[model samples]
Target: MYSTSTQKREWTYTPEKLAAVRLETNIKFREKYESVITPEELELFVTPEEELRMQRSIEDAALKFADKFRPHIWPSVKWTALAFFKRAFLVWMVMMGCFYLAMKIDEFYITIDDFVKNMNVGDPRQNAERILKLEPELMKVLNYNLTVHCPYRPFEGHLMDMKTRMLLLNFDLESIRRDSMRFFQNALQTDVLLVYPPSQIALAAINFGCMLKSDEILREFLRKMIGIEEDSWSARDVRPEDLEKLEKTVTRVNHIMREVEKQFVAVTEQERENHKSRLSQIQNLLPILNERRKEAWRAGGCIGQEPGLVTEAPVDSDDE
Candidate 1:
C-alpha cells in the first residue's frame, strides 16, 4: 500500500517492488485491525450464499455491459484496414528499394569502370565476361531474396561529400573510392550493418579499405564525423585519444565484415541455413541467460561465483 502522496507525485515501481509493498501494507492493516477483525470471523462473513450472490451480480453486470456494445459493433473495420495497410506498405518498400538499387548499380559500375582503367587490366574483355558470370554466385553469397534492404541509403550523401572533401585534402581519392566500394559490397552481405549504425559502418568500411594510405586524413575525418554524430561534438572538441579509440572501432567493424565475407564465400546455402538455425537457438537462450544473472544478483551472488558481488550488464537485443 503506497502512500496517497505517491499518487500526487510521479512514482515508478517494478512488479517485484509493487508486490512486496502491497503485501507489507496488508500485513500492517491486519496488525492494526486485529482487535476488531479475526480470521475466523472474516471466513464466516464470506459464506457460500454470499459468494454465489457476488458471482451472479458480476455476471449480470457483465451482460449489461455487453448489451451496450452490441449496437456499436460495426463488422471489425480496423482489422481489415490493418491488413490492407500491411500489404500496401510492403509494396511501397519494394518499389523504393528497386529505385535505390537502380541508382546505386549505375553509380557502382561507373566507378568500377574508372577503377578498371586505373588498374590497366591485361585483358579487359575476359575480366568483363568473368564478372558477369560471377553475378549469380555473388547474389547467392549476399543471401538476397525478394527484399533488398541496405544501410547505405542513409549514408549515401555523406560518403559522396566525403569523397569531395578527401580530394581537396590532396589524398589519393581514386584508391579510397575503389577500396571503400569493395568493402561496402562485402559489408552489405554481412550482419555488421545490423549490429552497428550506418555512420559507423560506413566509416569502418572506408577505414579498412584505405589502410594503405599514408595521409591518415580520412581516419581523422571519420573520427570527427562519428564524434559529431554520436556526441554532437565538433572537430576541435574531439581529443586525440578519442580519435584513436574510434579508429580501432572502425578497424574492428571492417575486420568483422572481411571475416563474414570469407565465411559466406566458403559455405554452401545448406550450410548457411544450418548456421542460421544454430544462431537462432543461441539467441533464444539470451533472455534466460540475463534472467539467471538477475537471480544471482538478487541472492547476493556474483555471476562468476563470487559472494556479495553483483554484476549488471545492458542486454544487447537484435532488433533487425
Candidate 2:
C-alpha cells in the first residue's frame, strides 16, 4: 500500500515540475563532469559537453556547405543544408523588400519638398514645415498658375507678342480672352492684394486686364498705378507737366478703344473682301504699335511704376 501510494504521488507530478527536474538534473550532471575532467582534457569525454561541441562543429560545417551547395544535389546532406539556407534567404528577402518600400516613400517626400520650394512666391524654405504637408499634385497646380498668371517685367515682351498674334489675329479668340481675363483676376487677388508692389503681380494684373478688354479693372489698376506715382513724388506737389502727361495716357487709352469699336463697325458694314483686307492690314499694324508702346514704356522707365502707388500706409508718430 505504501509503495503504491509513492508510485501514485510520482505519477501525479505536473509537466512543469517534471521539466524543472530535468533542467536541474542537466545542470548537476554538467557540473559533475566539468569537475572530474582535467582542464586540458575537459574538451574530450563529457557527453553533454562533447554533444554541444559536436553541435557547434555541425553548424559551422552546415554554413560552409550551404555556401557551396547546388540544386543538383537532390537527396543529400548538402541539399538539406541548402534548404535551411533557402529558408533564411527568404526571410532576408522579405526584410529587404520592406526596407526598399520605406526608402521609396522617403524619396517621394523629398521630391514634393523640392517642387514646393521651387514654386513658392516668397521663400518656400521659410515655410518648410507647412509646405511639407501639401501633396505634390497641389504644388504642381500652384506652380502652373503662378507662371501663367503672375506678371513680371520680363514677361511684358512675351505678353505683347501673344496678345497681338492671338487677339488681333482673332485665332482662338474666345479662349485667349477667357484666359487673359482669369489671369488678370488671379493676379489682382494674389499678387496685388497679398504682396507689396511695384512687383510682377501688379504688372501682370495690369497687362492681363488691358488685354481682356476689362475696362473697369484696367481703369482701377491704372488709378492705382497713378497713385503710386503720386506717392513717389517728394511732396503732394502735382507738377502741371506730370498731370498733363497722365491726362495724355488716359486719352490715348480711350482713343485706342474707340478705334477698335470703329473697326468693328466698319467690318459689319463692308463687303467680305474689303473686311478681310482691312482686318489683315490691322493685324500687320498691331505688332508695330505694340513694339512702339513697349519702347515708349521702356524709355520712360515707367514699366512697373504706378503713377501714385503706395506700398504701405505711413505710420503716425503720434500713435506710437
Candidate 3:
C-alpha cells in the first residue's frame, strides 16, 4: 500500500537529492535578486540550512499553537498539519494559516474568527484574510494532494507484532510504547519523514525504545527480526537484499536521531525575533526585485506573445 501511495511515488527523496534540491533553491533565491540588490543586502538572505533550523522552531511553535484550541485537536490532524507545514514552502507568518488549512482538510473545522482570536496574533481580521489568501497557494504547492500517512498507525502495528511474535524478550511492551511515540515525535524534527518509509521509521522508534531499555535486548530483537542466526550470516526467511535494506534503514534512522539530538536545540525567543525581522525584510524586497526582472525581460524582447485580439466574424462569437 505504501509503495502505491503518492507519498512514496512523488514526495520521497534520498538525502543527497534532498540536499541538492535545497541547495539549488538557495542558489536560485540569491540569483533572483543578485543584480537588483546590493551585496550587503544580499547577505541578509538565509541559507537552506538556516531556513531548515527556523522551520524546526516553527514546527515546535505550531504544536504549541494547536494546544490553544478548546476541544483537543486529533493527533492525526496534528500530524497532517505538520506534514502540510513541512511540504509547503512557508515562513513563520503563514505557519498558523497552513495548520488552519490542514484542520479544514482533515474535517476538523474551526471558524476563522475563533481561530484568529485563539491565535492572539496581530490584527485578527488581517490574520483571517492572510490565511484565506494563502490557502490557494498552499494547495497549489501541495498539488491538491492532501493525504499524509504518518508512522503512528504502523507504529501500533509493530507494537502488536512485537507483543505476539517476539515473546522470549518478556519485556513490558506498555512501558516502551510511550518512549517509542516520543522518539517518533522527535523524528519529525529531522528529514527522516521525507527520506524513509513510515513503517521503517516506526521500527526505528521501537529500536530506540528497546535500546534505551536494554542494549542486549535490543540486539536480540534485531537479530531475530532480521533473521540472523547466532552461528551464520544467512537469514532465515527475509531475503538477503531485504535484510540488508532493513539494516541500512535502521542504521540511518538511528543516525538521524543522534544528529537531531546534537543539532536541534530549543529555539530562543531572540533568535526567533531575528528570524522574523530577516523574513520581513526579504518579503519587502521581493516585489521590487520581481518588477525589475519583468522590466528586464520586457526590455530584452524576451516577453511571451500577448493574447491575440478577438475579432468579430459573420458568425456570432458565442455560437462558435
Candidate 4:
C-alpha cells in the first residue's frame, strides 16, 4: 500500500527509481511463491490462459503505478525513454544516413566558402600567418605549390620559398629577423601580385620590426607608410595611386635589395653589433641588397621617366 500526496506537482523519476520498483516486485513474488511452487511448477502455472490473465494483471499494475507516480516520473523518464528509442541501432543508422546526405547537399558551398575565405585578396603574409595557425599542413601545401608554379624573380621566389623554410628552420629570434627582412626585401621588389597600400606595407614592416626589436624603425615605417611625412618627400601626397606608382617604380630586383639594406641598417640591434659572425653575415648581405636595389631602380626607370607619376592629388587644406 502506498500513500498518494495531495500536493499536485510535475512528474520526475530516475532510472534507479524504476529499477528499485522492479526489484522489489520481483522479490515479493519470489517470497510469496517459492515455498509452494517449485521452479518447474511455476513454469507450468503460467499456462496460456494464466499467462493472458497475468499479462492483464501486469498491465493493470503498470497503469496504476503510472497513474500514482506519473507526476513524479515525467521529467527524466520522458527524456530517457526518448533517448533510448532514438539511439536504438536501426534509429541511429537512419539518423546518420540523413546527416550524411545533408552534409553532401552543402559540400560544394562549404568548399567554395573555404577557398574564398582562405585565399582572401588582402596581404598574403596575413593569409599565410592565419592559414599556418589554423591548418599548417594546408599552408605547407600552398607554400610548396606557390614556389613550384611561380618563379619570375629569384628574390621574390625565395621570399615565397621561405614559408616552408621558416616552418623547417626553427630559427632563433635573430635568425628569424634576418630571414624576415630578406623575405620583405624580396617581396617589395617583385610585381604586385596583391596590391597593398603603403599603410598596409607599413603595417607589415611594423609587425616585422617589432619581432626584430626595432621599435624605432617600426614607428618611422608606420609614419611614412601611413603618409605622415617628416622630411623626405614630405610635400608629396601619399595616395593609393602613389603607393601603386611606388610599387611600379621599384620593379628592379636591385631596388628591393637597396631598400632592404636601408631597412636592415635601420633595424639592426646595438646588442647584436658585438656578435662578429652575425655582423659579418649582415655586412655580406648589405652589398648584395644594394646591387639588387640598383637593378630594381634601372628596371623601374620607365615609371620614374613619366613625370608626376609619384605625385598625388593635393590634400584639402580646409579639411586638414
Whose TM-score is higher: candidate 2's or candidate 4's?
Answer: 2
Each model's TM-score? 0.30, 0.20, 0.79, 0.15
- Put down candidate 3 lDDT per residue, 215-302, tens digits, no spaces: 5654455566666665664456446775676567657667766755664567788887887788789889777777776776668786
Q: What lDDT tens digits, residue by residue, belong to model 2 across residues 117-211?
A: 33324465644534343323232322211111122332354445445533434234234444543443222211121212223333343344456
**TM-score of model 2 (CA atoms):** 0.20
Candidate number that wins on TM-score, 1 or 2 = 1
Instruction: Give the alpha-carbon lDDT of every model.
Output: 0.41, 0.35, 0.71, 0.33
- Using TM-score, rank the candidates from best to worst: 3, 1, 2, 4
Clashing pairs in 3: none
Stretches of candidate 3 above 4 Å error?
90-93, 166-171, 216-253, 291-302, 305-320
RMSD of 4: 39.0
Q: What shift in Å separates residue 267 of candidate 4 from its native position after superposition?
A: 33
| lDDT of model 2, residue 92 | 17
How far is each candidate from the true structure, as Cα RMSD in Å?
26.8, 42.3, 7.2, 39.0
Model 1, span 265-287: residue lDDT tens: 32344644554454355446544
lDDT, residue 245, model 2? 55
